[model samples]
Target: MPNLLSRGLFNLFFGSKRKAFEKLPGPTPGVLGTLGDFIGPNPWDVCARYGREYGGVTLIWMGPSPGLVLNDPAVIEEILLTRRLEFEKGNIGTQIRPTVGDTVFIANQGEDWSAKIKVEPMAQPWAAAWLAALVGPLQAAINESVDALLKEPSIDLTPTLRRLTFDGFAVAAIGEKTPDSVFEDFMLLAKGADARLQAKLPLRFVSFPEGFEAAKERFYGYFTERVRRARAALNPSAVDLMSWTLREMPTVSDAWLGHILGTLFYGGVFSTSTTLVGAFHQLQKYPAAEERLAAEAATLAGAPLTFEWLRGAPWSEAVAYEVLRILPAVRIFLRTPAADTELAGVKLPAGSTLMVSNQHLHRDPSHWKDPETFEPSRWLNGGTARDPAGSGYFFPFGRGPRECVGAPFALLFLQTALATIAARVKVHVDSTEPFEEGFFFGVVLPKGVTGRLIARPSQAASLPGSVHPSAAVKTA
Candidate 1:
């Protein structure tokens, strides 16, 4: 019966169009097409292999649905930037809808999406000041996490970073720190969403772990309450994300606001935390880079860790960019054509999925020098690396009109966290083994990676109040 259904789907999507994708290269599809490949242990590896062996544009079959893996920078630019309106979130958006609801993160290109983007909190010009105001709260959160790390010398940095990011995001976006229970609930919901994505099937068919529904209710309820409170205290001068969002779009529904806040929290917390883990891991591996960052941090000793200060630290910003380039949190971006289109001489049907592999593009030899090497200097000015701003090759935050709205805030948070930690302690990854990358609720993270922190005595005196001076000096 399943085989018959698979065959039926195959014929329905590609009865006569199979010939169109015949020239493109990809792994042979199974009875369920390339759906099996994506649900496997390492779908990212499959994407990398497809790009390496199949050239710039590779055809993939998602069951009956035909998709393209786009590795070419030029092709990506055309799809993501030039003809962006021609594409919408499509099936991928549907996959995420169960988790984030109909928020801007996964909303299709339409009037609602347009309105959501216009009022997206982090993308606003005043977003810098809002994020700047969060430095104290963010730093306090980071300090608490670092303090805990100091007590436990050997620990998995992933969880520590996760807690830090969640707390920081809460303070910045929700206007207060969330309880640990709420964080756990959010993780539960996020994990369920990731499971749905991997299933590559409709949400109805995907089975989640026990407590999933309760977690979802709790997570959404928390955000819903936040929206209500923001509405009650609506102020034109309020600078927090929820307040700002409400001020911009007063007529928006409470559920819509809740979903928007939930999506931002989910998107910001997990991805940012994973990126921080990767940054710390990379810093440990490349001591020279660590030294440079520490020195840069030292220069700003006693200086307030303001938004401007964090953004102005060139080497820290460069290292953050390098880590993002090498280990992008979001490995794959999914887009679907709103109308039938032609890409690289191949015709694509309307609604066909377009997958862009950041992992492949970030390391593509043609676009990067020493692509495999962990070289932070590549992002430095007057260096050999192309400027990511002008260069289409680097897009960890994605590109086009629908790019991650929290990009500026995320970068500032990353730069500040990296600089703060580097100044106070020297990171040492306990595991000498090469990192084994895996997906943690759709975000890329290292598995079983443990690290220790040694106090840097030189900068202890200059450390902030939140960061314990005695603990920093005694942690080693």
Candidate 2:
């Protein structure tokens, strides 16, 4: 079967008439045809090597299949914006279908995707309002998580931030806190899904990891019950993702609703956690930046952590944007030509895979000054960093019509949580080891930062509407 598959891919991508694809510059493929580079621990590093050596658009062989790494912003704009319809999430949709199902917005395409977009709660303009309404719950979640962090003199920031983001996501998504056991199951399910997406070809054909199905079932069951309970209560005044989804798609099945909720949680949590971790790590590295953030957060004393308020905190917003630019959670994005198409002056046959490296594009020397440096100030009005929204060079959340629907929520959450944390504690990284990163499935996980959370003596007390850790509700 392996030989047959290899022969099929070879014929499909390397036909005699495929002069255009054959002429594209890239490293010579190994026996595994560069598949190892993608499935290995440091695909992002390999992608950087490709961009640095091969220029903007480079061709790579994944098994016998031809995959193009789009490193140039012009080509990126062409594929992701100008000719978006020509390139869809074909291969990626197939890869994540087993985990998120085809009905979920990310995996759906064409007319179905168009229809789903309309009902997607996160895609709606009112999403900000829904998120704003949860400021109290979200702030409480952050406070509780920080309190847990303060319990120990020194600790690993990764798991702590993970719990922090998960709790915040629970409150914003489902109107309550989630149990640790459920979080464990969801992590297993997420990791398993990522494994399937990043697995080698024949293994990629395999559906789920060893215990994936069980973990998914358990995770789904918990969410299914939550969906049913939300339906039963049917609070029109409620302002969580689940509530919005229910109100928008009133007739959708409980299972379908559960999948939507699960998909958002899966997409939102880990990425936010890693971004926060990066923010803290960067802040610790640049003491002046930390001091500025602390000063800005200080002004928020006696004010609610509302969306409007968080939006006004420019430094916090800049820090979040900078961290996203420097350490994108999903390092690479996969797409495929829907039909024979030309990108960057190179013709690609239908179904050919395209890999866009966010890491490469984010750090491209041509578009950024000292691209390697972690400078949050670049995002400020007069700073050197280009606006990601306007510049094709930066797209941590992606670009075009299919850009991450959850971006607003993610940004709001990041700003609120970062400011809230800055207001409550000072993060001191005792070791440089945590700054090291590893690629997992597609998400970048930091090598757990060992840090001490020093409590700000009067910071919490100064906040007028602060929720005490003990007073924060643990249940719905």
Candidate 3:
């Protein structure tokens, strides 16, 4: 990374002078202006504001880096898919490489990214099996937390869900139950690393990077232990994610696996939690969905959620997609121009950084019918995909060769968790703990800053064969 500016310095000093500008596809800018508000209301606000003025491909100068803000689906698609070779994952990838090693998010273009995304099965047959395996454990975990909530009557779903996600990932990925300290390890490491990078935090003073190193060691020890246990136990029927990870191990190194797991967990737990939290927030604003979902779940009294049920649950999927569309867990996805190229016809010089803001594109009116309205029905036709090939439109799991590798796993996990909880209890937001809306180490998360959330009971009932925990929930 130190070599980045060094190589570009020559271009900066004596390169061809081309006046750069953002050619926004739309009109009417928001409050987020380059000269007006450097620090906009939120990351989304910044992109929304800039996107309105500059259109499809805008420019965001965050500190020293010049970011090409790609907020349209067409342009984003072209960059990510049509002309993907011309782009690598930009700044965030390099910054996180030191910590995450190099997997998908941290991997530059070419063999590394291709290899990572390839091992995972495409979005089809495995989707059913994957979600089926996940639904069983995920439901139990949600039930464990929700049943405990009955003791107090309410709790913030954010942190509780984070723990559940960690447990699910640990069990699914390595076929092992993670220690409580591991959760602490992730929160500490992810938050610490995010704070350091975002605020330009220095590591030398307090050994921040070393602390991350220690966390990595602990996580790696666990990863190695679990994989060995899974491989040695080799009951083909007992296979889980360890089998999947191991299958791809030959092409990848232990260090790569460690960082991938770490980054995957950070990404999985944080993004799912954020989207769920956002879902609850959206639900609160409109309580009708809560009643409808509960009522529907109640009707399937004798029918436990089979893989078929998940497929048939179009309304649930619609709501989930709507929540993501309105409030995408990740706002900014950065891609570096590997070589000089014209994006949306703007001649972005080689080595230029592109900051694609899904946040603004999510709210774009041209592609969407009612941009601000949280109408899940819009997604009933599929997604907010005005153009399937366009990248600037909507990509919760991203797209192309460098898109999210674990998307199938994540979708399964999230769907099961949401279904189980929504079926059993209603999440009522009772606090004003603001969700920190910013990019954190290549993913998005609720601000890890301090605050408590409150939740209360509802009239939701259990489906067939679903286990209700006999113990009370404990709040720490």
Candidate 4:
């Protein structure tokens, strides 16, 4: 095997650079090297098992490259919080840059990025205020979609939910509903960019997917048109991101504004859709958990679906935590050492790749009880019993400056979605076999996740806008 010999020679010659990591315990790379770990039928499972099989720190080969996987929470905290400035988002962030632009999600640590950090604080209050304002419209949209879907025997909910989230963005940001096809096209472009990133090499070259350029052009075109429309609005309101940015930063260029909005759009839609699909899949597998969530939702009968109502639902929050913990949309967070550093007494040379698998860290037995099992109760008391982002144990939206700026918005969206769906209808997995989790270009996907939706009898008398019911009741 000339390929094997060449790799062997490469490792043999430069292996000394990895000596410190080599001393750490991990799965022995098979003949295929670490490619065997990532390119297998289920790479995430291999990563999870590695956390169980190895020590706090494990070194794995990504073909000829070496990476240190941190399963220790302290080590995770050190990188995401204390030493955040030292490490950048690395290749994955780079891969996503052209798609998301230079928003907080992909911005590196630099003076240029300092102004970007303002987005979180600025968006925090803005999101809260706008969420309250958009609650009625959002409820209408979600209820309409649910009512339409309930008539079907079985359905795939990802697209519907993605549209619901996009509508929320529309009401808050763009002031109109976006076509479902737009979201679909955006996903393709993002995945294409991810593929392009994976195919990148030092000397080799590869072409992008055939339709990527067209999709990218269309994606940017939509934003350009929307930004133009926002600028042209006679009496612009501060409710949407574009309006707010234009009002607050009058001097910023239109291109920069488009990039900011595009980043938010991708982050919001991708995280919410993938998360909802995973949450529903898990609920189908664990009926008791589903029952608990439904029971909680049923309590809100005859009451308005307010922000308070969504936040107060205990089991709803627990389920959100469990779903995000087990099936984080963004799995691997790659960072490179800003300079030569030591982690857990292991030498990490300057620019060494340091990866923290959120899946592994969240599922690490040392931090979570019976990590393999889906136990929503684990998050009951404080909602962070095992994985608290504040403690650096759990960061589904990431941590530090680069942490997801849309996290609070994401939480609000998830709570509203789970509460609304559970309150009106019950979903059951329709397939005979166990649902298989699949990784796509970036997000986690539940392949062929078909489910039956049955409206609860009590729901007929409860919420408005029910297709089965006489008319839509406006909750106030």
User: Which candidate comes out best when scored by TM-score?
Assistant: 2
lDDT of every predicted structure (CA atoms) = 0.76, 0.76, 0.60, 0.69
Query: Cα lDDT for residue 472, model 3?
Result: 21
Query: Candidate 2: lDDT over CA atoms?
Result: 0.76
Tell me the tens digit of each residue's lDDT in model 2 across 283-363: 888889998999998776646677677757889988988889888887777788888877766777788878887788788
Which residue window of length 10 is worst by lDDT in model 3?
Answer: 26-35
- The Cα error of candidate 3 at residue 139, in Å, is 1.6
Of the candidates numbered 2 and 3, which has the greater TM-score value? 2
lDDT of 1 by residue, 1-476 (tens): 23667666666666676677787877666567777766645766778778898888888886677789888888888877888778886676656666677677777676877987776767767776777777766776676677767767477878878888887787777777788888888878787778877674567888877898888888888888988977997877655678877876688788777777777777778789889888888877787888899999877554557767775788988888888888888888778888888877788889887887778878889878999878988877754255553246778888877778888788878988888887667777765456787776667877777877766767445444333435644563
Candidate 2: count of backbone clashes, pairs at least 3 residues apart or interchain: 0
Q: What would the TM-scores of all predictions be? A: 0.85, 0.86, 0.79, 0.85
Show the lowest summed lDDT stretch of 10 residues, model 4. 467-476
Indicate whether candidate 1 or candidate 2 has the larger TM-score.
Answer: 2
Model 1 residue runs over 4 Å out of place are 1-17, 26-41, 63-65, 200-202, 224-239, 243-258, 300-303, 382-385, 389-391, 459-476
lDDT of 3 by residue, 20-133 (tens): 443434222222223234444665576677788767666543333345667677777777788888787656654555555555556667787667565533332453465566
Off by over 4 Å in 2: 1-23, 29-41, 204-211, 382-386, 459-476
Clash pairs of candidate 4? 464-473, 465-472
